[model samples]
Target: MKNMDVMLLSTSCIQSQLMKELLSESLGPSITLVNQHTFAYHDWNKPALILVDLANLPTSNQPWELYLRGFKDNISTVLLNTQDSISAQKLLQWPNVYGYFSHYEDQETLIRGLTKVLKGEHWIPRSMLIEMLLYLQSIKPITTTSIELTSREIDVLNLLSNGKSNTEIANELFVSEHTIKSHLYKAFKKINVKNRVQAKRWARCHLPLYDG
Candidate 1:
């Protein structure tokens, strides 16, 4: 049987090893586990998939951000988290963020999420998905602007309106926390808002049904 070449990144050496064992035991020797710090410097093109544990690492480093930006077209990213709201918002904006799984999710769910991501599908927990949809509904346009945002950017805006932090948003969207911040930085500039609080207030005021 051919093994799927997977690169697992985690700050916890033990957890990384455990995940490596799990993947090897379940899917066979085709999977390879590399330490997160080392994996960041390696060429990402060789992996069938890359699994990132956002909750376990720092998000502000330039190297990590560069790695993510560079790999968007070269490989798939599967972000695992404990549902950090702000993180979810930032990560969802990146086109490469394909899958998200909560730490609380069962093993079957984790496998299913990874499988879906590998198949080029975007996967988010059901509850978070619904919340995102509802947020979009709440922020429906009252007026169209000259400014434009991608569908994913708009999704990030809606989550911001719901008071989620970048970390939370990243987890929700299955993206790296750094990716989420990048989106917010661009979104804020485009929307003419200075910070998350201002952005949310502006969105609420401009959105069709927002009473505030």
Candidate 2:
């Protein structure tokens, strides 16, 4: 209620007016709702949350998306009236997008979610959060030398990436399966991987001599 700015980017004048009134009443009169069709003239550095209605935008690269690319720092955004989870997930991948509201969301749910977003908290689903985390983990830079893996661990990972099972790796290394498991566990911990598949993926990216 302390003059928090909320910019509504919508094409329809009637809808924008209605939404502005609703938000003002629900979120308190101190909340400033800057209803506008374009965002080019606004100061990008201001502390404001942008609520973009995706329904009125074209199917291609949106105006907000293009405008967002200009700024070096992240701008907080909440996507409204998203068609489905696929689009929501894709948009949420942008660092600025922290909240989403489907067309089917009730007034109460929308208001509650907006409140959370205003507090600088994420309003995304748990499943989406998990998927984002996994994606970030996969793309995160980890040089092979950074983890300082033991020679046996590196050998095990190289073989693992080449579709070799634990038993096969053990046989190739002339060590027992238990020893191979120990090496894998240590490697996984060092590399922050939870399982063989993740370890293998990491190996493929970091290990230059990986066969697979």
Candidate 3:
């Protein structure tokens, strides 16, 4: 791995020097410090991993997404030196960022993180993953208000939401069990749900205006 370049991106001169010394001393001497101006010039070296010091760099203007896009399947990316781990949890959503370590962590921990990342393993904070899951659940749209469901489907869904079994709903609506199942299947498709529980949640949220 001595031939492989490890790109360290940063805007601060002092930090660039410090991180460079750290990587070179702890990891090895193969580390190359590069900024936006020099990064394009070294594309031929083909850095194996990018350790992004987001605390210094103006991340929005860098087209970092496109830079990652151009790397295809080769380069592994990691983010560091952030103020908030909870808020920074969103970066885990990106496939390229396989590793994330808060800059405040000890050098030993960061070295362990880098070792794991270079071994093709992820290194995110455990709490960040938990926060990410809760955040995803919070943002996940139920689509009850957004979806357009048919009246017959709504009827079946309403009964289903009210805890009526398929046969019970069919009897209450004076429809055949086959007809009720058909309505349920269609409702599930329209609302983008799979099972009776999800269908019930959708119906309860969306059916306030429903009379049928």
- Top candidate on lDDT is 2
Residue 100 of model 2 has an lDDT of 85
Q: What is the C-alpha lDDT profile of model 2 across 23-115, one tens digit per residue?
A: 878865443344333466676556666777777655333334434432435356788888765533365434477778888899999999888
Candidate order (lDDT):
2, 3, 1
Report lDDT (CA) for all predictions: 0.63, 0.68, 0.67
lDDT of 1 at 7: 70
Q: Candidate 3 — which residues are off by over 4 angstroms?
A: 1-3, 44-47, 64-66, 85-89, 93-95, 131-212
Who is ahead in lDDT, 1 or 3?
A: 3
Q: Is candidate 2 or candidate 3 better by TM-score?
A: 2
lDDT of 3 by residue, 1-212 (tens): 33456878776498688988888788764677887555654554454677878777775313343244244355667887766533533474343677777758788998987877777688876877677667656553434566766655655676687788988776655569999899888778888899998887766666652223
Q: Which ten residues in a row have the lowest lDDT in candidate 2?
A: 61-70
TM-score of each: 0.52, 0.57, 0.53
The Cα RMSD in angstroms, rounded to one decimal, for candidate 2 relative to the true structure is: 15.5
Question: After best superposition, candidate 2 residue 1: deviation in angstroms?
Answer: 10
